[model samples]
Target: MNNYLIKTENISKRYPIRKQNARPDTLVGTVIDFLYKPVRNLKELRNLSSAQNSDYELESYIWALNKINLKIKNNEKIGIIGKNGSGKSTLLKILSRITKPTNGTAIIKGRVASLIEVGTGFHQELSGRENVYLNGSILGMSKSEIDQKYDEIIAFSGVAKFIDTPIKRYSSGMRVRLAFSVAAHLEPEILIIDEVLAVGDASFQKKCLGKMDDVAKSGRTVLFVSHNLESIISLCDRVIWIDDGEIKGDGNPLQIVNQYLETINNISESQIDLTSINRDTNSSFQFSKLIMMNQNNIKSSSFNVGDDLIIKLKYSLKDQNLLKSNLQVKISIHNSTQTEVLNLNNEVSGYIHKLINKEGHVVCKIPHIPLGEGIYSINIEAIINSGAADVINNVGSFEIIPGDYFGTGVPNNTKANFYCISEWE
Candidate 1:
């Protein structure tokens, strides 16, 4: 008998790209187009056969997963990390049987429960209580089995106050809470969760992580996909890094997570051109550039522990009327481990900006930087009238070398992200 609970062999999935002019604008064309789909498919097959195997030339289709092979042993907790649009969710959906791979085989030896998206496998028209039983039955649980676990599910979800209300009335957070409660409590042999847990509050996310830990301890398997690296490191023993629909790295959680973080920091530069990075095109006010400098105002990406650091943010406004609104600029500094060490913002500093131009600069100066020796990334966020206008993560990064913050001439602790200056009594 196979000891692996889940196994996939050369699994791949691709979706046909819809052309802009492929569909007709009129009814008669729609009918003819529908009738001729088979012919079009045959032509596409011929084109695919004659075309190069390179993804760039394959305009007709885009591969979401590319020949992924994995073996998940029983009770193993695995975390999948990747950028957005990567194949993490596709692989989970395949293992959950929610979708089929285009060309490959996946063997699941036991019952599997998945929470891929918010309120997935839930009926909006049905009451929360009813959906619980419904989802349990879908997982092959009998009425008696559902009855045995219903209260515990409701209690853990913290949605008992509206258990009898229709799911449409519940907030996204509530639905995720209930969905996770049902999926985790139904006693499925394997639990597959996507980033949907991000919809829940921090406390609830904590509770869910603890429960997943308990589930894994009970000899059940878990396949989790999340962008939260800290949670992945704490909860999972192994991690898999996927990029461009292929496995790039897989091994120890910290090692794989560090590999993933490296890619994010790889984009960092002394002067980051934020306008070129992927961002919301509709944003009214956006950051255009970020320049890091030392106290002398010379551009730099390296700093000593006690050195003064200056960050200059250049932004552009789409509308001049936005000048009337209160603009706030914030920057978050995080360590190599992705733990945030400091947050600097204009609003908190009681500095109100007087915007007189469509484009301008905002400068944040920090004196006596207490950060220990390590690499740090900076994330920028712009808010207008208390509403987020533009938010960009990992906009740039800097390095901090060893320095004496306590005036003792001793090097700061490298393990910690920040150092404190305290006088000995």
Candidate 2:
């Protein structure tokens, strides 16, 4: 018997970009071209007719996966980490047999299941109950097997009341819940998951993470992908870092995660450039920049505990809306674990009335930074007419370091998360 359940040898996938041409001068020309086009286009026919067949000359291919080689042993839990468009999902798709590799081979020796996206294998018109069996059949399970797991799946999803409801009527969160429940309960030999967990609420996210931890402990092979590095560290024993369609590093989770965070920090600019960001089409206002200013009003990204920190948000409105009456600005602070630590909004603070310009600025002044030593993220929300005009997540991250806030030189205990001012009896 082979010890490795999954093996890839120089696996590569290339997607071809169809030649884009401008629209024809007339509708008749477009219709004629569409209806009378050759089965093989002229360029392809010419290439095939030529004996030399200079196929390498074509530059219309994007390499989504590049020479990905791995020997995943049976029952070894793995976490895949990468930035957006880094080909993490592409690799998972290849492993899940959703797509074929253009080059090389990948051998799998067990049943595979995946939750790559919401409603991935579901029919929107079908009821949730019907989709459960449909998905089970698609996973190659027999009717008897589906019957055995049906109750467990429905119970875990917490949508038992709506089990007979059409999936199209379900919200995005509900769809994710059912999809994840089915994928997790079906008991496949290999389970592949993507970042779809981000769709769930905080409690559900924690529950799903715990279930994944349980699944890994059951001695099954699991390949998980997420941007939450804290969860990755907690769940995975081994981590694989993918970047630009290639594996950059693969080893211990802590070491790889630390290295990846360092790379991200190095690539990050000193300050965020918000003006270049494209606003959503429905946005009534758009954010420009988020600046961190010290007590002296100098811009910076680092601050010490107990230091007064000012967060300045600059934005522009689409029309002349009174800032004091029509606009609401909200700011949320989140730790590296992606947990919200604090939130502030104009509705609660009553400070937007101070602004008097179309180009608006809201400054949040903290008498003393309450957070301990760690990196924190800022999320900005702009609301107009009771609707979200603009929102940004993880826009700018700053670091809080230890300082002599108290008379004693000893640093405050970061584990406890706060420094208490007390009197010695």
Candidate 3:
């Protein structure tokens, strides 16, 4: 008997690319296109042979996942990390039976509950109370079983007052809370969650993480995907990194996340242009540039312990009117081990900016660098009116050299992430 609870063999998925000018809406055109697809494919295959290149035939489709072979043991906590559109969600969809692979096979030997998206598996017209039973039944749970755990789910969700309310009227956070509560409490052998947890607040996200930890400790399998590297490093025992529809690295969580972060490092110059970086395009504002400097206000990437480190972030607004809204900026510092060492936020620091132009900059100053000797990376995020406008990871990195933080001139040699002043009693 195999101990693997999930196994995928050479799985590949492809979606046909539709031409922008192709008119397939008409029934006749649709029929003709359908009938001609086989001939077109055959011609493409012949062209592939003549051209001696497989890429010639792959122009008509995009491969979301390619030749992925994975075996997940029972009760393993696996974290999947990748850039946007890198096929992390596609792999989870395949494992959840929500989608089929174009080629290869996947075998799952346990019941699965997936919260891939907010409000997924929820009925808009049905009450939250109804959806709990509905999702439970979908997960192969009996009514009696749901009944036994119903109160627990409701209480965990913290939406008891709205349990009888329709799902359509529930906020995104509320829906995620109830959906996660149901999926986590129904006792499925395997649980798969995507980035949907980002919809909740900080407290709720912490609660959900705790619940996931408990579930994993109970000998259940968990496959999680998130952009929060800190959460990934803390919760997952193993991690798999996907890039360009293929597995890039798989193994220890910290190592894999660190490798991924290194690949995304975009700091090639003292001042980097952030306009062309990959990020969410729906936001009304975006970061334009990032500049790092030393205490002398000169561009530098090397700093000593207890030295003042300065950062300047430039941003632009799509609409000038948005300047009236409150803008918040955050900077996260992480060591080479992918562990977050410090987070600096304007809101937390009680700094308010009064902007008068569509383009402006924010400056953050660290009075004394507390980090030990090592290479560290910076991640930046901008929020407008409580909505995340831009988030760029590994925007830059700086080196921290040895310095006497305690002013003892003793040359404190330690591998710790940060150092603090100490005195003999």
Candidate 4:
């Protein structure tokens, strides 16, 4: 009566690295270098290659996954979140059986469809139409089954025009669209997707999310990894936060996302170094620092209710043409629970409509900080007139202390989001 579809018992994965610079890969170069280099180095290389590949001590290795244990039930929609190199993709690769673990075991009970990369199961020499049948066969689907879904897949992918052409000529976006359409339609018991969907256009990404929603609704297990918190919150029932190749937190999507956001607060003494943040989005400008100021004009991360709060973001343009471009700044404020409490944008505020220079700052001021006594974080984004230029989530955080917002010794409505300045009848 066990419903668990996936189980990993202390699963770990390690990758070896060269003790020094990597040895030359060309056969001729390797032989020449061995003859020219010191004999001691050659002996070391021989010993390194002789040991078992699983042996962790033979050479320096990175533990991509460390003692990870998980049990996922059928039909569960799980979201995975982490900073770059935090092993989110590694875990997905292990679960998909593309990579083996180093120290533990994973037990999977059903068919898996993984869209981890473009052209994952495709052959470059094969036509798109042939690759569809080949990929379906590899997924254990019958030819008849693939034929039944073939038109739908091609239609969804919008690649029907090139179905008979070799996939080597397909662009990355086209390949991903076709791959995702096939994987989602193949009726696999479990589906795994990485952030490669970010390569698609906005409309296609939306289509993929909608298709994933349908997949989850059809009583299949799904493991998704993405930096889009809003999409994760909408599609995932549970979330796991990974840090340094270890599970930092796992539970409710909202709560775990909040926990992950807290750690992204690199701001100190009211200044955040944006270069230290790991962002996945592209941009024509890079952030330099984020500074918060109180009404007294002192930089601080703590403010009292009803006090004026000022946030300033400094950035440098990567392209000089962007200076003349119509750009805007958008900021979102989230409560400690990761629920967005406020969203502000330059277009709405009538503040920064365009850039005046290649390097400068944007300022946002709230005359009265209207928030209950609690901690909150800030998410900042720079957008061109066309699309997003840069996005930095949870870049800064601030705390609000209790204050007499009602202009009396006793404050009004202390439990809600903010106090209401009212005189009761």
Best-fitting candidate, measured by TM-score? 2
Tens-digit lDDT track for model 1 on 105-160?
Answer: 99999888777765556899999999999887776678899899999999999999
TM-score result, candidate 2: 0.59
What order do candidates take by lDDT, descending? 3, 1, 4, 2
The TM-score between candidate 4 and the true structure equals: 0.58
What local lDDT score does residue 23 receive in model 1, on the 0 to 100 scale? 28
Q: Is candidate 1 or 2 superior in TM-score?
A: 2
Query: Over the stretch 354-410, how does candidate 4's per-residue lDDT look in tens digits?
Result: 666878888889878888887888889887745556777777788888876655666
- Residue lDDT tens for model 2, 154-212: 99999999999999999878887888777777578898988877887888888888888
Distance from true location, Cα of 99 in model 3, Å? 1.2
* Candidate 2 stretches greater than 4 Å from native: 17-56, 267-425
- Candidate 1 Cα deviation (angstroms), residue 20: 5.4
Model 3's TM-score against the true structure: 0.57
lDDT of 3 by residue, 86-189 (tens): 79999999999887777789899988888787555689989999999988787667999999999999999989999899989998888888988887785788
Report how far off residue 182 is in candidate 4 (Å). Answer: 1.2
**After superposition, candidate 1 runs with Cα above 4 Å error:** 19-58, 169-172, 268-425
Give candidate 4's root-mean-square deviation (CA, Å).
13.6
